[model samples]
Target: MDWGLVLVLLLMGAFGGFSAGLLGIGGGMILVPFITMIFSARGFAPEVIVHMAIATSLGTILFTSMSSVRAHHLHGAVRWRIVALLSPGILLGSWIGPWIGKQMSSTVLALFFGLFISFSATQMLLGKKPSGGRELPGTVGMFAAGGLIGLLAGLVGAGGGFISIPFMGWCNVKIHNAVATSAALGFPIALAGTLSNIFYGWGVADLPPYSLGFIYLPALAVIATASVLFAPLGARTAHRLPVATLKKVFAVVLYCLAAYMLWKAFH
Candidate 1:
């Protein structure tokens, strides 16, 4: 094993896990860009690097999301009713997303990821609130909303918080509840997205060793181990911290990452 690479992944996991707990974002927004950088630097085929990064990021979320959500659940923050309502659609959309991604050229996919992250960052920076009196939609409406959230998240390897939190907030759900529910929802998004990526990427040419479809298993292992440990700490901190400040700082970081991805796409 490359010890240097392990160190990098460990650090990434620690930070990503903390973010997952704090933001209910599953850390994929952070992981995808960094993983892409690492893979690109290591001379992995450009065509596969972004996909592998995306898939592996989701794979790590499989562990981190659980740890994060458990801590949030302990805090009585999760809205389980919303999770149940949204899951069926999330599953279907998540699976379809990676399949669609598999058909796109790497450059186009990278462009999409970059643009979407930029949009998410803008949403964060603005910190918009919904008008009062709006309520969450009924089952059919929620399912459709969930599908949209899942699709966008899978395409970009996110946990869907960027969309779901805002949607819930617009419907007058409490912020903490929205965050916790988004964390609970991450598991299903990651599960379907990971499986779909694996299926679509199976037997692709020029893939690096130790790949399970598009996922780099070694990175997944290292990231997941470190991320799970840090996630609870982040969840606890989320209850105390001024989340607005954190979101603004994180937004800046995301903008930078988006810029990097855009540069990579062009090159």
Candidate 2:
């Protein structure tokens, strides 16, 4: 429990949580690479560091999403019907993702995370929407969409808002509803993803101290606490401001992260 490390984690948590509330992402997309850096610096097993990063990112998402969703719920923005429809498939897909992911190397996972998040960021920046005549999918369609979202989210340690929001928007859901619903979906994604990480990484060698499989308990504690505290504030800010421009700024940040990960992979 180094004080310096605790401070860094707290700062990371605050940023990630605030971003999650504000942009429907910012949790895992932001946390994964930074957490990877920390774990690598600490000299954990190279094969397992990205796994730990993704798992810990998901762990932080658990609290941050709860906090963000509570704020959205207070504003009557969350579509519980949609959440209910999506959760089952999301959970199933999330559960399967880590098992698949555990076979890949840290470098490969990092590269994937970098590319995927960058694509998500590009889509956010574009801010495209389909025509208004379309509507959200029916039960089966929603489940399939949820499954895909959850699997990608689990593999990359994202909250899935980046993809889900766009998907909903394409289906002619209102931006607010889509964002709110995406926040709701983060819960299942994080929970199932964390469970998968635990199971998939169980009994692997050279896990850091205090790790339950890939989920680092100490990092989870510090990051989750700070992220939760800041999430509501971000939600409030979202209510106050127009987010289109902000997303462009965030997109640039995500691209930088992608570039860094690519650098790390090849260097």
Candidate 3:
């Protein structure tokens, strides 16, 4: 094991988990690119590197989301009603996401992931609000919305907050509540996605050791360990941080990552 690399992964996890707590995202946006670079440098097959990154990102979220949600719940920010309405469809969509990924060419998947992440970052940077404060939709509509979130999240290994938060905000949900509720929804999205990735990657060729299907357990273990510990800290800091500044900084970083991935895909 590369202890140096392990330390770096720990650092990334800490930051990622903190962001999850602060921003109500699952931290996969931070994890995927770095994980891919690490796997690539370690000589993993190019075809499977992105899969490993995505799978391990989701697996790590299984733990990080729990820690984040607990902190948000204690603050009474989580909307249990929203969670209930979105969960069933989230479960179904998440379960199918990795299956779709595996069927696509790795390069194509990377391209799509890059474009999607860039779009998400652009949304944050623009920080647009809906002109009308419409109420949330009916059960079927919420279910459909949940399905879309889950599918996109599964495809890109995110917590779905990039979509969910914006969606809730458009519906006039308070920002804090939207963040907390998105954190709650992240678990089912990740859990179902992770399980599906594991099953989907079984018996695949060129997979690295210590892997469970598409997931690399060592990365998950190291990242989750640090993320779970620091998440509460991020949650607490969310109350004090200059969020607009932080979001801008984070958006810059995401844009860079997106550009890098897109360059890699086309080059």
Give the candidate number with the greatest lDDT.
1
Those runs of model 1 whose alpha carbons end farther than 4 Å from true positions after fitting are none
Q: Sort the predicted structures by lDDT, highest score first.
A: 1, 3, 2
TM-score of each: 0.99, 0.98, 0.98
Error of 3 at 32 (Å): 0.3
Q: List the residue pairs that clash in candidate 2.
A: none
Per-residue lDDT tens digits for candidate 3, residues 1-267, read 789999999998998899999888789998898888888889899899888899999998899989999998998999999999999889998988999999977798889989998998998888787768599999999999999999989988999999999999999998888988999999999999999999999999999898899999988999999999988887777667776677788888899888877875765
lDDT of predicted model 2:
0.87
Pairwise TM-score winner, candidates 1 and 3: 1
**Cα lDDT, model 2, residue 199:** 87
> What is the C-alpha lDDT profile of model 1 across 1-267, one tens digit per residue?
599999999999999999989988889999999999999989999889888999999899889989999999999999999999999999999999898888887899899999999999999899898899998899999899989988988888889999999999999998888988999999999999999999999999999999999999999999999999998988889899998889999999999999998998999
TM-score of 3: 0.98
Best by TM-score: 1
User: Candidate 3, clashing residue pairs?
Assistant: none
